[model samples]
Target: MGALDYLSNFCTVTTTRTKHKAMQTVEIKVRMDCDGCERRVRNAVTSLKGVKSVEVNRKQSRVVVSGYVDPNKVLKRVRSTGKVRAKFWPYVEQHLVYYPYAPGAYDRRAPSGYVRNVVQAFPDHSSNAPPQENFLSFFSDDNVHACSIM
Candidate 1:
């Protein structure tokens, strides 16, 4: 046997290692009105396995979940609360119907330019506005008033 052939036999082989990706944050558009509703939804989601943290913004009517849990599974747990319903925000196409645009309702919509004005009036709402932009636009005065919760 050649010297090169003998060396090849003793060569050590190494495999490349792949790192697992960190879990993504899941944002859910939930219909929660009161403190009780928020608490119920928060408790339900935080109790699930793989859930690292949960933030429920009652004013924005949204829940942001960060953890290793599947988003769908987290949604199911939030919905199971029975006090309110939770859905992946992106999947809610009919925001007007799902959220309704009035004034007081948890799922209600704000008026036209409401977002911009909110930002002008309260800069904090600006940070919270982006997530609800699509939902708010659906409530423009030109749209059907039937969907208005007011």
Candidate 2:
């Protein structure tokens, strides 16, 4: 076989395009003080090629972008709009936080109903079960070793 025939047999020739990112929602915190700020951020994010939608919540200083978009690009776009303080949303709902008033979880500046989500800020959840459960566990039938106290 000639060189062309040898290569064709070994490798199929096909055009390839860059892989697209998965559809996802990226939430960002942008301190939008006025309608102008909100509009600016929304405009910047919507300009991106793959952005399907942009929702700006000025009250909560939150921006939710949904579609096949790169999160870094979205954040960069928001910052480029002169919202220098823009960043990925760092807070979770107060209920998700183990300690609502944790030293780091509690943010006076954060909007109501949310708290900073930091691993170190919350106590371990494994210990949160009631004390009664611990005593009952000792007597559980599954326990091969019975408690000495009956």
Candidate 3:
């Protein structure tokens, strides 16, 4: 047999013998408020069987768990934390939603409204101004003082 034929035979044999496991990473929407809540949820999830890792983002109210795990089991474990509420977000097959926060999922109405106000007020200013600066400027005015100490 020639080298080409030998290589093809080897490839075919390897392909026949090898099997791939279907490991899935599931992203869950969690309602978390603080760092303590996040820690509680993370610990609860990481303790579950087949859970490789757990990541909790408090600001986003989301958790990402990866491994060969049952999505239902994972959700149950997360909910057991009692610090947050967890749910699976349905994903589209063609789009392949990998992360928890789908489009506009993390977008908040308050921040968007604030952005709209800023844009309306400063229509002439560059739209590219950093959001942190804009938020800070909103708080800097005397009329917006947060504390009035007696």
Best by TM-score: 2
Q: Candidate 1 or 2, higher TM-score?
A: 2
My TM-score estimates for the predictions, one after another, are 0.46, 0.76, 0.46
Tell me the deviation in Å of residue 27 in model 3.
Answer: 0.8
lDDT tens string, model 3, 1-150? 699997898777443563543588887778777778788888888888778877776655668898878888888888888733467742232222233243333334222212112222322345675544444544535666563332
lDDT of 1 by residue, 33-140 (tens): 788988988888888877888998787677999987788788888878884455676323233233323233332352222221121232344364555446655575
How much RMSD separates candidate 2 from the native structure? 5.7
TM-score of 2: 0.76
Distance (Å) between predicted and true CA of 144, model 2?
23
Clashing pairs in 2: none
Report the Cα lDDT for residue 131, model 1: 53
- Evaluate all candidate structures by whole-model CA lDDT and list the values in order: 0.66, 0.86, 0.62
Query: Sorted by lDDT, highest first, which candidate order results?
Result: 2, 1, 3
- Supply the TM-score for candidate 1: 0.46
Residue 101, candidate 2: alpha-carbon lDDT: 81
Q: lDDT per residue, candidate 2, 86-113, as tens digits?
A: 8999988988766788677788988899
